[model samples]
Target: MELDEFDLALIEQLRVDGRASFESLGTRVGLSRTAARARVQRFFDSGVLRVAAMVHPEFEGIHAFGHVSITVHGRASAQVAASVAQLPDTPFVSVVSGRHSVVAELRSPDVAHLSDTVSLIRSLDGVQSVDTLILTHLLKEPHIPAHGPGRPEQFDETDRRLLNLLHEDGRMPYADLADGVGLSRGATRTRVLRLLGTGVVSVTGMVNPTALGMTQMSGFQLHLETDGTTALSVIGRLEQVSFLARTLGRCDAIGTLITRARTETVDLLDRMRAIDGVRDVQSWTHLELVKEQYDRRPLRANGAAHGAAASR
Candidate 1:
């Protein structure tokens, strides 16, 4: 998407606090609430935004995966990409134009699932080679750092507080949240609607993997012949997978997932590896996740916006 100053501004606003209201956003951007809503809707309809809830695997149950760099043997990278993406354990695929080009995230129930995912990869149509590694600790999953080169502007205190409330529970009602956060319900409702409309703070239905009967936690990195981040959605629907993303650097894509299938082991792995582009992998058995965040919002340090919106 062609990102202009206004689009960048919108993104910055969301980065500060995903749950900012339409009225609140309008106030910040010098537009009316209706205009702000229209602008956000346009961006969304144009495929310029993506908002998802990413959960920690170990936080919910027993799940694991392997990460590897794979090198696809032929130009049919897309076919291979599609094949690997079809695996139940894989929730994301990236076809890149470098060494170890096809990076993928594989989900599994246990070590067996890990082995199976590998076997599946080895058996794919265009796959030439596969390497495997297990994850020890997740230093960081996917995160947006505030101190990055082009990080968003410093959020005022009010933005921070508003974010804090939503991170606690994205689904919290505006009326109830208004009382908790010291805001009028109408204003709170407007603010939250803006947040959602702007591709921020996506309130979604989430289920604990363990609670759902999955019994393991893990991760993987894949290497492939071709590279790109267009296959994330295709991979996200994998049976037990939860989160899938097209990363900027490092691995082409990644997925955090859960599972409980036994016999679908080696065959699955072979099929994945054998796919056109996959060549290698490394798996990390997630022992624990120190921190997990889905854009926890933070108002401006001075709470200026929150107070202003509330008073209005």
Candidate 2:
């Protein structure tokens, strides 16, 4: 469905704060509370927007995560890509045109499981070689909340359950959230606020880029001549980059670029190349995003979360 200005505005507001009240949404977009609620429901029913919770792995004691680039033999790229996307560990998988045929993001609660998953990928038919980029720091992630200066507050079992419910439906009403976790509405609201305030989790709306008319998306790897701190600051200012991270592997950092057209991608690449400290930049055009979702491991029991994810 084609989105108009009001639809876009509502989407943008939800992206900033998915739990914003209908009154606030309507006020911002010049609609009545009833109208705003109806519009949001329409977007959800149409699959144009998904509001979900993203929990910080570090806060939950699940730390292993990185990117894997796979080179495949001639006709096998499609088969291999499909196979990788089915794995529980891979949150993001895409077929791209570049030196590597497929790229995926892997997340596991521990290193051993991660290593085993890598071995499994290497054993796949048509897989020639696999390259791993261990993420050292996540500078920016679209739906995931950034854990700013302070430490995360301690949470209990009830909090975990609340997070899981939020992951299932970010815009779930306070009364419903309270019922699920067996807490009073007022108390539940306070806990939810604390979690959001501490950056342990974020409940936000994620728009389908294609639905928003962003037709071109690519993954980029950068090798910088100087230390990454300054370069990171500069790169972070660009709105097109949805995800950015410092890594240890073939490149100093990796990020994703989403643009409206191919021309915009070219322009963005040229601008990135012009940054003072960038030595070289490699990018792969995303032919298809087979899978893309924030990790849901935190919602699962640790024992059950094993068996997939790893680096080369």
Candidate 3:
């Protein structure tokens, strides 16, 4: 859909504060509280937005995906895609239009669980290969910033406070947020820059594909020569990368998420392969997601980057 400027503005506000109130949202976007509320409802109903409980994987430190890749046979790709996508342990799935067939990311309780899950997927129909990318040290993982879309860039602490309040309860009052964070309406209002600034968090604009008349896009994993300096640099140059993080497992990066364009992801991967010290590129198109909570939480609470928008 060709989103209108107001729609984009409306989406932008929600992107900053998913739970942004109609009143406060109106204030930011120059609309009536009633009008703002209606727009938000429209976004949700249209699959353009969905607000739910998001748990930081790092907080519990349970079991995050450790770079597990599954490949299915020829036409079995569909069956393979469905089988793994439906796996109980699976969280993220993409049936890509690529070499690997189906690429999925699953989280388990422990390494043993991961082993068992992969074994199970391997045993599934049309299964030809499975690759495990164990997460040893998380440089980055599934994260959300202030305002981007579903995934946004890190906003300032001022903005983070707003997020923290919402994280606890998306329905919190802006007046309460302002008072709790020690700022007036206008001052706090000015800090929304964090939504567009730097930090660990990011936001993303989400729309239901079924409603939007499209299917999911594919993502490829690139193992680069270095961290923040190298591998990260490769990821930075990829235009198709909707999200990137320095993670702690098999593939130092993640975001095999549903993309708007498959060709973009592939083109980015190809560019990465040309970089020096770059090894091979493995692309996986997740088919189905028996369980996916990407629109969920940030990292650990205590471990949350100090002064983060979500901090206490």
Name the best candidate (by lDDT): 2
Each model's TM-score, in the order given?
A: 0.44, 0.90, 0.63
Candidates ranked, most accurate by lDDT first: 2, 3, 1
Per-residue C-alpha lDDT of model 3 across residues 1-312, encoded as one tens digit per residue: 556677779876765555556798888888899988887778877776655333344332344455556666655665676666666556566565655666666666577877888888878867778877765544334243332222323334555566555466555555776787899866765553333343333333344544443455555555655453565655655534554544454655555434456675566667667777567666665555433545433433333422112211
Compared with the true structure, what per-residue lDDT tens digits does model 2 show for residues 13-121?
9998989999999999999999999999999898899787777666655577789999999556778899998787787888999899999998776777687788888
Off by over 4 Å in 3: 59-61, 73-75, 137-216, 228-239, 245-254, 257-267, 270-312
Q: How much does candidate 2 score in TM-score?
A: 0.90
Clashing pairs in 2: 114-309, 114-310
Candidate 3 lDDT trough over 10 residues, lowest sum: 303-312
Give the range of the ten consecutive residues with the poorest summed lDDT in model 1: 303-312
Residues 74-118 of candidate 1 have per-residue lDDT tens digits of 757666776776665555465644556565655555778778888
Clashes of 3: 46
